[model samples]
Target chain A: MVEERMNTDKMWITMGPQHPFSHGLWTLRVHADGEIITDAEPEIGYLHRGWEKECENRTYAKIIPMADRLCYSASMTWSHVFCKVAEEALDIEVPERAQYLRVIADEICRIQSHLMWLAAVGTDLGNLTVFLWALREREFFLDLNIRLCGQRLTTNYPRIGGVRNDMPYYFERDCMRCVERFETVGLPEIMKLATDSSPFVGRMQGIKYLTAKDVANWGVTGPAMRGCGVDYDVRRDDPYDAYGEIDFEVPVLNKNNPKGGDAYDRFLVRLEEMYQSCEIIRQAFQKLQSIPKEAPSRVKVPRCIPAGTHMAKIEDPRGESIMYLVSDGTEKPWRLKVRSPIFVNVSSSKHMVDGVRIADVPAIMAMIDMCLGETDR
Target chain B: MTEEMIQAPSYEDVNKLISEKFGEKVVFRTSTKKNVKAINEKRRIFLSTDRDTILELCTYIHDVLNFEQATSVCAVDYIDRVQIVYHLTNYFTGIVIEITVDLPADDLHIPSVALIWEGANWHERETYELFGVIFDGHPKLERLLTPQSYEFFPFRKSYKLRGSE
Candidate 1:
């Protein structure tokens, strides 16, 4: 009976399109032998709305609002990238005030997006306290979003040449306070519960590890790539907007560590990134104070873009998000292609969970911070 | 070449290397936009090559030039011909090279670079399904966004969206 049991063939186990850990409509079919997974395949595109084709119909200005819908958690960066590409096509420059404003808004979005991911990781690991605390902290950042832009999630704030508007009266004070509170109070509390907890660390410490070589080969970006000791960030390496002037550390896990690119390392990298985001916001506010209050934030741009193919890349909360715009000297774009980071990162799921056990799949995959909106689009 | 040049070659050096290797077969275009800011943005290179030489060109870029990542592989339909663009980036020098290959309407097949960089696998698949540009050796050239059985290439100029004429 023992010999027969050992000789059983591998079976394929399907997870999601609706599973809780998936956090979106995508399936992961795992080829497993009892508990250990031999291979994995990710199937996405449930949220595909033909986003690229849709852009071809709309004018340049109208596309900014639609870009916000690409990712629910980090909507600001999506719209910023769209506007940046349009600005590139037009060969225009953003005003100084708008550049600083975009930087602050983007860092806030990064912190909040990472918090959202932390909350998802909590659910995957059977911890409700982390989920609740992370979401509660994320609320403060979303409140900042509402104050900057009228809406909360899909911020139609970034315009073609600049931002929609300047920071409202005393908006900087409130933003600074929120960042400080989160840094001092909100972060410590979450760290105490999650990172400081032995059981939580034990669950994530050594599972689903990847090497630096594997990460580079598979085109993983953002914190996931940083976790594997790849010291590249689009904001720092390929600077855009006001990011070139700002100084901040890109946290990367040391490859020498045995648990270097595991779920825990990725978790640590994102958490540290939140702290860095707070620092970036603080510096951006300092720079904003020097610029004249009445400086023009948004510039007037032509309705039609000249015939050109331009690309703009930004450091999104999840990864390096890029927009490739091909204009045929018309009001409407000829073609607009989005190179979403999650879409590429998710392709390497098989390598991510190759030798991991079945029960560890969710925790391992959670490090990706999967956002299907951008992926499917 | 100096040690620093070998490790992280400047854009000019890489351009020289490619130009020397491929000569007149590849046409180079540099895109530089005027910016009002004090610190100007870097210029990006766009190299247009025939589809026949893209595979070999990619191998040199990966092995010799050390462009470790294929940031994107996308196809644009020109109504007359299809253009496939591959954006490859070198992490060390932060240089991005945009390679474009035009395939005539009748011949939409181009060799795949997914084997050279595994990250490009899905990108090629998406381009195949949407633009109907066949990547000759793509490991899995299946539908990425649309249903597998969907016959139309929605991104092509011929296949119109509902609201667009």
Candidate 2:
């Protein structure tokens, strides 16, 4: 009876288009042996809104607002990248003040984006306190977003040549306050709840491992790639906007640790990145002070772009976001392609989660920081 | 525990090596826009090659040239012909070498580079589904985002978008 009851065959378990751990609408079909996941396949595109194809219909300027919708959490960077590409196609330079403003806005987006990811990771690991604390800090950054731009989540602030508007009254004061508080008090308190907790570390440490070679081969970028020991940050290496002038350390997990590139290493990379973003914001604010307040922030550009192909890339909070623009000397674009980091990163999920326990799937995948709006777009 | 990373090839070195290898078959052009402030615009490199030897050319780019990442794989429908564009990047230098393969509209078949670098797998698949450019030798060439039953390649210039004449 005992021999007859034992089963030898492995089972296929389907995770979600609607599962709680997904954080978005995507399905993961995993081949399992009791508890260990042998193989995994991810099915995305549930949030597909034809983002690339739609850009072809609209004129160059109209797409900036649409780009903001790509990722709600990092809306500033999305719009900034679109503007960067259009700026390249037009072959124009952003003003000195605008470059600093873009950098400040980008770091703001990065901090809040990582905070949102932290909140998601908290709930994924079944910790309510971390969820609440991370979200509370994120609220202040979102409020900063409203102070600079008119919108909270979808900020259509970046224009083709520069930004939408100059800094509002006392915007720098408010931004500096928020960044300081988050760096000193807000981040440390949240860290005590999550990073200092043994249970939180226990759930994440040594779970889903991807070597540096595997990361490079799969085209993973941002914190996920840095977590795996690849010291490539577009902000530092490529240096679009004001990043070339600003000085900050990019945290990589492989520096001190021999066994890095696990879920926990990725976690540490993001946490350290939040701290670095604070430093960047502080520096950008100082640089802005050097420039006159009357200095131009927005440049007037033409409606039509020249007939040529141009590309621009920016270090998004998630990864390296690139845009390719093909123009036909018309008001509208001939072809526009968005190289979303999450799209390529999500494709490598199979190699990431393989051989990990089924219960640890959420923790491993949460390191990816899935934002379906960008992924599906 | 520190692994040795490959040093990225400079733009001059990359251009020289490709010109030597492919000779007259490859057309090399450096982007020169007058009075541009962005670094990427002045530094961008473009290489035009035919679809016949893209696999071989890309293999050399990947294996010999040490381009670690296929940054993007996208297709453009140019009415009479289709252009399959692959942007490969060397991380150490932050340089992107864009390779464009011109395919006749009648035959949109090109050899897949997914086997060379697994990162190009989904990019090729997405290109295949949206533009109907069949990437021959792709492991799984199924529709990624669109409905499987839909027979139209929505990104094709011939297939008109809704509310547009």
Off by over 4 Å in 2: A1-3, A255-260, B1-6, B35-43
- lDDT for A123 in candidate 1 is 86
lDDT of 2 by residue, A169-284 (tens): 99988998888888889998988778788988899987877788778889998899999888889888777878889999998878434454899899989999999999999999
lDDT of each: 0.89, 0.88
Predictions' DockQ, in order: 0.61, 0.65
Fnat of each candidate: 0.69, 0.67
> What's the residue-level lDDT of A236 in candidate 1?
86
Tens-digit lDDT string for candidate 1 (A9-33):
8999999989988989999999998
Q: What is the Cα-based lDDT of residue A97 in candidate 1?
A: 94
TM-scores of the models, in the given order?
0.97, 0.97
Candidate 2's error at A182, in angstroms?
1.0
Per-residue lDDT over B43-80 for candidate 2, one digit per residue giving the tens place of the 0 to 100 score: 46789999877988888888877788999999999999
